[model samples]
Target chain A: MFLHLFIVNKSGGLIHHRSLSSKAPKLGTNEWLRIGSTFHSLYAIANEASPVKLPGNKKNGADDGIEEIQADGMTLNCFQTRTGLKFVITAEPNTTAAVDLGQILREIYMLYTDCCLKDPFYELEMPIRCELFTQGVENLIQKYSRIR
Target chain B: MSRTPVNILDRPLGGRGSRAETQVSLSAFSYLYSELVQYHQNRVDSISELERRLESSGYDVGLKILELITYRNREYKREIRLMNILHFVSTQVWKAVFGKPADSLERSVENTDEFMIIDYEPLTSTFCSVPADFGQLSADGYMSGIVAGVLDGAGFSARVTAHSVALEEGEANNNNTNTSSSSGGAQSGNNGSLLPPRKEKAVFLVKFSPEVLERDAAMDR
Candidate 1:
């Protein structure tokens, strides 16, 4: 029932992460930091590999927000309960269900934006610091942990 | 005297207590407005410059929104009554976008060629303080554009301009001392405060061209 979460940037590099279950194996701080930096570097490589450009001979200045790669995509996970707290997990090309994992990640993003991002206390581009996100995530992990 | 039937209270924000059809969150609105003001404030010089920038920005949004609002109005009913239409803009239209009605709407008594819609707090230019850098950006002009679009959509042809009529201490008379009674006559820039009161206020001058007056007179005859 435990799930891992990773936030990969547009370049498919991991930026943030957490485990869905308390009982799940813990990653060392150094390991997590290395994973984040490595993923970030890989993301840059992916972007360079697929440097998007406009069609019809349009030599645009920069890419127009749509880019993807096929060499194993990143996965973002989230555990949620009835009250909307979410436990998020993310990783690079490691989940059995990538599409389902993506759906969960999108939902978590929505929740985070609605609760934490909208909250005045949360700063932009900072780590998720809202009590609601934490509580939701913990509750979801606990619920799924018992079920699984 | 066959007076035009008054449909003033037919609007959503009319005195009869009709509710708004849609609800918008105040936090979202304030946050958006704050960002808009900030965006317009950056790279502007004088207060007039800041007002111009904000006015221009609001003008685009106003023009688009006016079209949508008028379309919605027509959907509910066919031809709109003139007074009712003015009231609609002053109340429902204003409240729908800015969360409040205009402060006042006064028709000129002498020439009868002008009307003024006043708002004590104009939201478009709220928090717009000109920065010390690059001099030229009038938030007021954007707001004026918005007013012009709305008025034109409502069939009133007028040149809308946002003016900052600040009152220097002891210069109140020197500011708005000469109030004219004639319609479309020279408007005194000293009608009220420029910087929104702790709350904001905007005055929209709705001046009709000579042709519109002639049409109104013909309709009367």
Candidate 2:
């Protein structure tokens, strides 16, 4: 049921975006950039606005940001790591099965650490255009997302 | 590819070494460190420049080490807060590299963005005796560089510097006397200590960028 995946760097830059399904939103390149930066700021703001402040040090689950956005057709699930990397997936609300997206997101993160981080050519905060990383993500998203 | 000669790059950078605790002897390390310093001295014109070179070298190692350790860690433990990252550097990072954690982790009294990790008898400089020309230079610049690399890798951009905080013998004695009785000093003096009194100290100062401070503040408000 997963439709789209987005990777936002710590600086709020849209480093990677993939439409996992035909049902995913179609947008201009600039729009994705806007979405990444917008989500970045909003994540921080949401934390500040929250009545119960999450501890800053360790893993703060659901964090200070919006974890899910259940719209009419799309349900957006966000997983933000302690290092400020955010993984977002938009799924069909009816078919995504109320599953824990965080587990899959963590898996994707491990892929990132191994494929992109281990690559000497890869620089932090730069656009992730690594082939191995792309392949790794594809393998993960395919495995985790329910067959439509 | 199998026919090609195997070198450092070809070998597996596996996590097995950490488990095996493959430690290098202090004497061997001293020899390597002196050679590294001498190599940098020949390449750089100024002491600061030499230090920067050392820092950059350490930075390379720091980046990989931080990522490796975090990746190896099984728990969901990742540092988000400023204190958390600093604590990781002083304790976890230091312990991994130096076989011991830093002596103390302290926040700057005046500047909120600044923090310090004091390491008494830093591993890299244990046998290093700097030339008079490079007076007051701390050989632990590489150590500070590693700290900087780790912070930057973890999304906290910062500048880290290593300084020598070792006091003169007379002053050190006087200070020790003020804190403890003279009779107590004699016992400590001949207590068969491994390290001599008035040993040099390497203080690593980490000054984070303003943006980090702002972001952290915004998290609260």
Candidate 3:
């Protein structure tokens, strides 16, 4: 599946964007807005989403809910890393296909960590504010998506 | 002159005078800079003025670093030519303080006395959002001041200006962090630094005033 992406810094300024794969069909303007709006909604919901656990965390003295978002389904998933930076992933429906998509998203995150995050220009939470991360991910997605 | 036999480690190059190699914590420097910004805030009457004031502070640090570097390397033979001195300052002196040479240094072809030092991510500018109420103060002035102070002390009278130059598209972004700010953001400030994915890199332009060249020429006679 091809996913067109836009990265912006926390200031909401667009930093980088491109299609991830050749096979993934480009979503139209209406589709793109729908995805963004859905993603934003999901992100807010995800913050409240968690696995089963006690209401209060005694160990760290902080409340952390026990819930995991399944990687499956035709939906948008956004994950923010420890540094208050956000990551968004979208995939087609179902857990089976979504599982691979999830893995792919994780790989993309790792790729971002390795390539863009390591670049001095990539400021944290500033959107996919790093140019190098954008290029590296694009190449990887293109090279691997076709082969896979 | 304290005249105490300085540790051998202090001497970078084998020279007659002693050179001290002082290790400063990045946290300490950041805190100092923060305080300096606060101090400048008192002197300024407006919000943007505060940032301009802070930039001048960075410039002051730059100048001090340049001076200390020159003092540190006084034992080295005098660089006869403008280029020679610039290289020595940019590479040797700059590296000593900032831990790497500037990202680039260039002489202005249009003007004989103008030189530029480019820092991809200037330390003062990074991690700092100039708050409103400080007036037209920017960190750029501080960085420029440092360069100016260093050049002036080195017998090269010139103006150094620090402008924000972000390279949004370039391969140099990946490999150049080591020369930039690996140890730069360890702040003593409240907002803890997220570990740097890579270090910051900077380029400095050094220009020699015509007076400096003329003096060197006269010395040759």
TM-score winner among the candidates?
Answer: 3
Residues A17-121 of candidate 3 have per-residue lDDT tens digits of 455546456766456545545554544444456343356534322133211344453354444444433455544544334255445555666656544443333
Q: Write the residue-wise lDDT of candidate 1 on A90-146 in tens digits.
A: 444444332444444545564454444444334444455454555555654454445
Q: What DockQ number belongs to candidate 2?
A: 0.01
DockQ of each: 0.01, 0.01, 0.04
True contacts kept of each: 0.00, 0.00, 0.00
Whichever of 2 and 3 has more DockQ, that candidate is: 3
TM-score of chain B of each: 0.56, 0.78, 0.64
Task: Pick the DockQ winner.
Answer: 3
* Candidate 2 residue-wise lDDT at A41: 87
DockQ of 1: 0.01
Evaluated on chain A only, model 1 obtains a TM-score of 0.56
Error of 2 at A126 (Å): 49
Better of 2 and 3 by TM-score: 3
Per-residue lDDT over B1-221 for candidate 1, one digit per residue giving the tens place of the 0 to 100 score = 99777585653432223343344343354346555555655676555666666666766776677777757666546323446666777876676566556667888677476677765445444334333243444334655677766666656656666554443454322212221111111211131122112222355666666765666567766
Docking class of 3: incorrect
What overall lDDT goes with each candidate model?
0.50, 0.72, 0.51
Better of 1 and 3 by DockQ: 3
